[model samples]
Target: MTATSTTAPIRIGVMGAHSTGKTLLLQRIEMTLRGYGIPVNRTGQLGKRAALVPLPKMQHHTVASTEWVLAQGIADEIAAAARPGPEPIQVVLADRAAWDALAYWHAAQEWRQETPHRHDRERLLVLAATQAPKYHLLLATALDPDIPVDSRHAYDTRYRTLVDQHTHRLLAAEGIEHHRVTSDPDSQARAVDRAVKLCLKEAVV
Candidate 1:
């Protein structure tokens, strides 16, 4: 890996509900960034790896599960920024972020009719926004009418949609800077390219 030109590596998050093409987009964007000789660390689906119960078997996970995944995601992002190599990682492409985890926690609570645990919510929000190395650009994959949702997630359309809605609501409430990438795959990749370029430009300035 090559060292990054900047002291802090640039972070970019690709976020959306399950099967919204976030992983594919993250891979493509990472490839593009690397072509420019940017040292990159691409993280994919932290929740899947961190969750105690396999995602396919669970409708909703416990708060401890959510917190565990959140902590793992934050730790990975921080470590990527601080990693030692020939070059600092210039770009860190994340499949989803801490905010996404928090959103899922909110959605799960709603589904179970559990009360709002304000402290947990606040803790996550603060860590995602402040303690964690924030994403310079967060690319959100919107659910477009033309693109059908992948059925592998048990095809619970209502649940998936609810999670998506909650994710959007949390993003808005936290005032995170993000752009929705919609349309076809080519357009989505282009959107990511543009966002990354803009972020790099700003980093230069």
Candidate 2:
């Protein structure tokens, strides 16, 4: 395949609910892509993925809840790992994204407004913002109740909406096109493959 000077490895991130086979899906993608000799890198395989679990120092902020923290860490690692544009297609699998909307909404009610934002907020946002242009695609893995599940908050539909909303906002703000995939792992993999084929084309001119 001919290469282009402006094109690079399309960075792909996979996100979804806990214990919903995200790891399995990630592995599947890596294996399938590798089989085709299409360079694919798993964050863990690189031994540098940042897991964004919340820290106890500042659990007070709802926006930086544990789940959100997990997402932030994953986002951070991907951002940090990303080299400037103009390279081959690279794929990074992050298990989660910023998902503290539920907690944030709950706290927004009682918590006093006008207070300075926490450190986590700035850092996490910076990570998302900076990586927006660096990534070619953002894949959101939906909660898969198929393989056993539990509603952290009664599986509240509201929370899911908020989660997707928060993610969309972040991606939009960063100027990146984000896509939400279904619970079916196969769909997720196929989507990535299709996106690569479509977006990673060689020089057009």
User: What is the TM-score of each predicted model, taking all chains together?
Assistant: 0.82, 0.53
- Residues 1-205, candidate 1, lDDT per residue (tens digit)? 1123334567777666777778877777777767766678877657667544554212375667677777777778877777789876767776777677777777777777787678876776676665334666677777654567655656566656667788788778766667777758677967777756854664432
The top-ranked prediction according to lDDT is 1
User: In model 2, what are the clashing residue pairs, if there are any?
Assistant: 8-87, 8-88, 9-88, 9-89, 9-90, 10-89, 52-69, 52-70, 151-155
**Alpha-carbon deviation at 41 in model 1, angstroms:** 0.9
- Tell me the alpha-carbon RMSD of every candidate: 4.3, 7.4
Q: Over the stretch 19-113, how does candidate 2's per-residue lDDT look in tens digits? A: 44556666776676666565555553211221233232121435434434545555555563473545443544444433322223323323334
Candidate 1 lDDT (Cα, whole model)?
0.68
Off by over 4 Å in 1: 1-6, 52-58, 131-133, 149-151, 199-205
Candidate 2 stretches greater than 4 Å from native: 1-7, 44-91, 94-123, 144-147, 150-165, 168-176, 195-205
The TM-score of predicted model 2 comes to 0.53
lDDT of 1 at 192: 70
